[model samples]
Target: MIYLAARAITTVFLLVGAAMADRTGEGGATIGSLSMRWDGQWYWVVATAGYPADLPLDATGHVTQNAWAFMPLYPVVARALSFLLGGQYPIAAIVVSLIAGYVACLALYHLLHARIDRVAALWAVALFAAGPLAALFQMGYAESLFLMWLFLALLALVRRRFGWLYLLIPLMGFTRPGVLAFALLLALYGIVRWRHRASDPLPARQIVHIVALGLLAVVVGFSWQWIAGIVTGDAGAYMKTELSWRRSWIGDDGGFVPFDGFVQASAIWFRVWGLPEPLGYVALALLVVAGAALLLFEPHVRRLGVEVRLWCASYALYLLLVFFPQSSIFRLLLPLAPLYGALALPRHPAWRWSMLGVGLALQWWWIDQMLVLGTTFTQIP
Candidate 1:
């Protein structure tokens, strides 16, 4: 019920934002159109046109932004759903996101309930459902669907249900670009279980399952690159397509370099805002330190259990390594939803309600900036 209400409230915000955008002469300002904005349009292209065998190139002979950067699962599912809706891909895409978002909420609640009290879990769901990026719940983005798979995968991991992961990991890997983090989590989890074997039982069968699952995740994570390479006859096709987006901001920083995105982004962003470049590096270091401390030392975060903490750590490291911090950073951080359980730990009504209120306010701000009035490159959601 709480989750439903939160979605309803976010829907109202989206509708109002759409109406406002319509008045401001924004192109394709209807609710359906707004839902399909930004990356939503890319997914639409993927669903309708399908990925090209030949990569699109610019005058400079560089890979231009194309559908290959997007994974196939969400749009493919939306395309199937569209057939049932008389070929209404937009409506089908939104429906897929809405349903997936609700299921993700349920999975999250259950995941948190096992580690914290029922009330805290509910509060966490409330916050997650009405979060600043909650708009993704109704939009035609793949995020909600990806989150659904991710939450369920985490639930399965927490309960020692390794068999479910055999199915979920592939779904997760195809749905989004974060399954490698899950692979890392499995490796860390196996080590932790091995170290605690004296007190907690670590069976040989479970060890085999963990090792196999880890290997599967790695294979699935890199499978898309191989698939793209095979189809395009260029092993670097997927990597080049992804780097094309970074080029728009950083102007072709050469080949893909792990962990260099953040460094380059930090300096670039700070310089854009009229700040010293050195401070950006210093700030990046501080941010990394702060994140590590929160995962290792924070008491409330500890209560969410090792699996959740490991996931948070793993996903954060993944982002630091591959992702360039930009406007979409908030959207990318949605996988860290489990950490909301820690924020909900404070039992004060004032604190909880205030958080919800602030979340809704930020949701409106995010929608207005990224969806309603945004027209420039920096406003990419």
Candidate 2:
């Protein structure tokens, strides 16, 4: 009942937010138009126009953004659904996202309920709904689709259905490249369990089956890169295209920095707080380390089960590694919904209610900044 009520209320919030966002400077306002922004536009292009035979490049020989960077599954699904909606790809994509988002919510609720108390489970659902990028769940984006497969992967782990993981790997991979992080976490867990000879009811033959399935998961999770290589005839086609956007971000000193988001945040601290840059960076890094330690050592997180804890920990690291802080990180970090188990921890009633209030305000702030304040799609997440 809590899940159903939360789902209905979230749906209402999203539709109302979409309508408000739609009423921009332009006279025409539609849900599809509001939904199909930023990455949604690229997915829509792929669904309607398909990938380019040749990688598009600029005069400087840098790869220009193109459809090759996006995974194929969402667009493929959107294309098929378009037929039902008179070939309106944008509308079709929004429909797919809304349905997927609700289903993902259900999966999350079930997974939480099985592990945590009903109150915590309900709070986790509510936390996921009130998150800053919760609005993205309503948009024509793959976040919710990827999340559906992700929570299913969690459910599979809880059930100890190791073989089901193999299927979810590719399904999740084609939905979002972040599945690689998930595959790695699973493989690591399997390896540790095998080494410890953990209490398992499975026979030796089933152990072998589990190992083989893990290998397949890792391979299939990386299949998108191989497919891009085949299509563009460049071994690094996907990474190159995906990283092309970083050219603008990397500044004059060109190279990837691990935990670049932290570095960026440090810079923000220096500018905003007038702290010494070195001091600011160290302070930010320490804060991050402290937060990570709390999550890892917290009794609440440990109680969420080993698999869920490991998955959340691995994904948080993945975000630190690849996701430079931007408006997009709001959506990127939505995959960390499992960690909302923290919200389930016993806290003062005022503290819990205050956190939810803050989250909802931030959600509105993000939506308004992106939809109403920003002039271009590039400015929005």
Candidate 3:
């Protein structure tokens, strides 16, 4: 445990620290103070300055595309932590992002070590710590914190403490509506498991509990939308705004068009974004195929219990909803962090080499462009 903890902290410090400094600034903590690429800068700014609700966006308003506003949970956390940290939101945001990232790694170490071989577990986690997605963990975004919540919930499920999963799943719903699927999936899993073991008399308590959870997902997933609608009264507006965050998935004819349209749009997500051409898409396609393969072939997976399925399923569902086979190849596949240790970690030398090579090359490239230089500020006006 001690060695795992040390390796976990050391890996994050080396990887995330360097990349954050590169993207935010050479000044280490100063990089995330300004918005860089996507949702990060806005989270940090709103945390410190407070939420801005006006149109066309005020200096303080973190702009949205259509319906995709900043999910409130992380920024709200940023705000509270910023207040606690003497009003230094930048430092606060950095602190939260870094701490959450390490905590997630530590949890990964603990969770994976139990399932995978010791050495493979260590390397698997190290793979995640230094993987391409590690860059996102450093930004003032919720991915790391969101991941922590996810792993914790699934870890509880593994222990067969259904109560914990029930509680935690709703919290995930509050953070990202996408997470609501976890609750729904768990209910489906519960239903299927019960039906398969027909003679094993269903546990009344568990059935009621699981159904209650499914209901909760319905509320929490849309509560944010309900609130937003009451305030803005623009049903499609918010949905349109959210599309900007996922244009890679917005589709060719502006929706989930039929076969031809989907093929064209998916082609754009891959070709225009260089997702598949870069080999990343190949990895994602492989993972998706692997998941489909699981549902098709694995019969005992359900009997092995909900923890194994739910944790793995949550990430698989996340990928499917986003559905951009190219960009997601493996770069943003960090949600698989828990699975790093769950499988028999890269046993074959050939497999290990491929995984390591792809992981390292892609990770290095992500960091190279993520950093920001501050020289423009000091130049003569």
Candidate 4:
């Protein structure tokens, strides 16, 4: 009920934003079009036209952005639903996202309920449903779907149900690009279980399952690259396609380097704004330390249990290793939605209401900036 009401409120915000954009001649008059903006359009292209056999290149023969950057599952599901909706991909995509968002909420609630009081768990769901990125629930993006799978996978891991992950991991891998974090989570989880074997029995069967699931995650994580390579006849097609976007932001710095994107991005962003590059490095180091301390020492976060903290650490490490901090960084952090439980630990009505108000305010600000007034390159959402 909270989730549905939150979506209803978000719908009102989107409608108002669309109207405002239309008034400004920014071209977001209709809800359908608003939902299909930004990367939503890319997903539509992937669904309708399919991936290119040959990589599209610019005048200098550098690979430009194309369908290869997007995963196939969400668009494919949307395409199938479009057929039942008389070929309306926008409506179909939104429906898929909405349903997935609802399921994600339920999965999140259960995931939290296992570790916290019922009221805190419910409050976490409310906050998540009305988060700054709540617009994602109704948009034509795959985040909600990926999040649904991710939450359920985490639930399975929490319950020590290894069988369900065989199916969920592949779904998560195809739904989005972050399943490598899940692979890392499995490794960290195994270590924790092994260390506590005296209290928590890590039987031989469970160890085999853990090893197998970890191997499965790694395979599925890189499976898209292999598939793209086979189809495009370029072994580096997927990586190159991903790098194209990063290059657009920070220029072609030769080849892809793990863990270098943030270092480069911090310097570039600070230099662009006329700040000292060393300050950016200092700020980045502080951010990393703060994040680590939050997971390791914060009381509310500690109450969320070891598994949740491990997942947070795993995903953070994965992002540090591969992701380039940019406008999309907030969206990428959606996978850490489980952490909302920590935020919801405050039982005071004042804090809860204040946070909700702030979340809605930020949601409106984000929608206005990214959807209404997004005419330039820097406004990419």
RMSD (Å) per prediction: 0.9, 3.0, 6.5, 1.0
Q: lDDT tens string, model 1, 1-381?
A: 887898889889888998899789875577787788889999999999999999999999999998889999999999999999999999999999999999999999999999999999999999999999999999999999999999999999999999999999999999999999999999999999999999999999999999999999999999999999999998999999999998879887789889999999999999999999999999999999999999999999999999999999999999999999999999999999999999999999999999999999999999999989877768888
Over 1-381, each residue of candidate 2 has an lDDT whose tens digit, in order, gives: 543454455456656656675565554555556667678889988888888878888887777778887888998998899899898888788778777877888888888887888777767777786666777776788988999999988888788777787788789988887876786677767765776675755468657756776677678767878888897798777766776765565533344567775687567647656777788778867967886786679888777877787787788777777665655766777888887776765666776677777777787777667754556634657
- Cα lDDT listed for each candidate: 0.94, 0.74, 0.57, 0.92
Question: Which 10-residue window in model 4 sums to the lowest lDDT?
Answer: 25-34
C-alpha lDDT of residue 216 in model 3: 73
Q: Write the per-residue lDDT of candidate 3 for residues 1-381, one digit (tens) a residue.
A: 432443444344445645666555465443343223345666655555544353243254433443236567777777788888888766666567677777777777666655655777666666676665665555666777777777776666555567786677666765554666566666766767687767755578877766776677667777766666655665444554554444434432363322332234454556656566445445556856888667446643433244556646765675566443433244345565665553325467677657756765665555444433222311100
lDDT of 4 by residue, 1-381 (tens): 999899999999998998898889865387778789899999999999999999999988888889999999999999999999999999999999999999999999999999999998998998899989999999999999999999999999999999999999999999999999999899999999999999999999999999999999999999999999999999999999999988778777787889899999899899989999999999899999999999999999999988899999999999999888887788899899999999999899999888888888888888888877876657767
* lDDT (Cα) of model 3: 0.57
- Candidate order (TM-score): 1, 4, 2, 3
lDDT of 4 at 15: 89
Q: Which stretches of candidate 1 lie over 4 Å from their true place?
A: none
Compared with the true structure, model 4 gives a TM-score of 0.98
- Model 1 reaches what TM-score against the true structure? 0.99
